[model samples]
Target: MVAPKYSRVVLKLSGEALAGSLGYGIDPDVVNTIARQIKEVAESGVELAIVVGGGNIWRGVAGSAKGMDRATADYMGMLATVMNSLALHDALQKHDVDTRTMTAIEMREVAEPYIRRRAIRHMEKGRVVILAGGTGNPYFSTDTTAALRAAEIEAQVILMAKRVDGVYDCDPLTNPQAKKFKVLSYIEMISRGLGVMDSTAASLCMDNKIPLIVFDLNQEGNIKRATLGEKIGTYIGGELNGEGDH
Candidate 1:
């Protein structure tokens, strides 16, 4: 098998993806499948860092606020991410892959706090780092967390594993006429408001010149295909090629 083109990459997995078809909470079988895909890519000699969202457990901004404060709601959302990270860590371990869960919040009982140098060192030693707790602050989405972690760890690409196959001009589910973009530039995505990711996260990747690959993780081996430089989805970056951005 050919090695992945990028030496290091960060994977952004939504909590809903972990839920599989049922679409509610963490499904062990689904998580194990994802872990296996990640393991396969890791075996290809690519360093991996994962940033998982908390939407399956909680969406602070979307949920009814009631008496909950905005900051508190966001903190609850961050905790939800920690739960997802721990689940992923366990699943990776089941695949015999070394993994570590680091949180932005200091939760020593469950995992280590986020430390940039330590995260880089873990990746250097071939351990997949699962980053949780959303930048240790409120008002930042996990998408932003992925971008921040990718920049901090010097990852070459951000593999955004979504339910959809790739970036569409409109929500493909609702708009039958929506067109799928094979390739996109950061400026194009921003100007068009394509919703590939939040503007903040997209701008960060653009500034750092980190390519983003939006692909459907539901397809078996898609993650591995992505790491191996296969043209499987929408590629957003400064350059365009059949194998995706280099």
Candidate 2:
């Protein structure tokens, strides 16, 4: 077996990725598939931690834009993330994979509270850790949470799984001629306004010198491919590579 590129990694999944074709709720099939892939990664001797979003259930920014209190709306979004985390935990448990869900908001009945040492201990014990709730605060996106957790846990890279194959200069769905970038620097990503992640998250990753791989989650085994360093998606925060940056 080929050795994986990174011993520890942070897998960032958006809430919409769990929605599948339904586009509103957790799709069991999608969750199961993700669980299976995650199991594969864990079995490969890679320590994996995940940070999930809550857009499928509710988007705090959207709610705030519609007249809800920004903090209240964001808290609701955090709760939605917990729901997604529990659903994922159930699926992984069904697969017989040892998994733990840690929340930032301290819901002891449902899951463990977010503790930096405890989370690292779980990963060290070969258990997958799912980090739910966006930093236990309003105005911080899960993307930022992923960056924060990765830095805390000393992860080598962040696997940013998305619906699209890779980051492009424009909306690929609408523009056939839009160019896909194979690799990008953090400053370039920020200057280009790629929208792959919010500025705060990108800046955090940049400051920490952590690399990110943005790839399509819909494709089976892509996650594992990322772990093995197979060159699947746009690599951000690295030396300049001269391919696919049209």
Q: What is the TM-score of each candidate against the true structure?
A: 0.95, 0.97
For model 2, give the 10-residue run with minimal summed lDDT.
237-246
lDDT of each residue in 174-211, candidate 2, tens digit only: 99999999888999999999998999999999999899
How good is model 1 by TM-score?
0.95
State, as a TM-score between 0 and 1, how close model 2 is to the true structure: 0.97
Report the C-alpha lDDT of model 1 over 1-246, residue by residue, as the tens digit.
686778899999998999888788899999999999999888888989999999999988875367677788899999999999999999999889999999999999999999999999998899998999989998888999999899998998999999999999999999999999988988999999998888999889989888999999989999989888888889999655643443
For each candidate in the order shown, give its overall lDDT on alpha carbons: 0.90, 0.94
- Candidate 2 segments exceeding 4 Å error: 241-246
**Per-residue lDDT value at 179 in model 1:** 96
Task: Give the distance in Å from residue 223's predicted Cα in candidate 2 to where it truly belongs.
Answer: 0.3
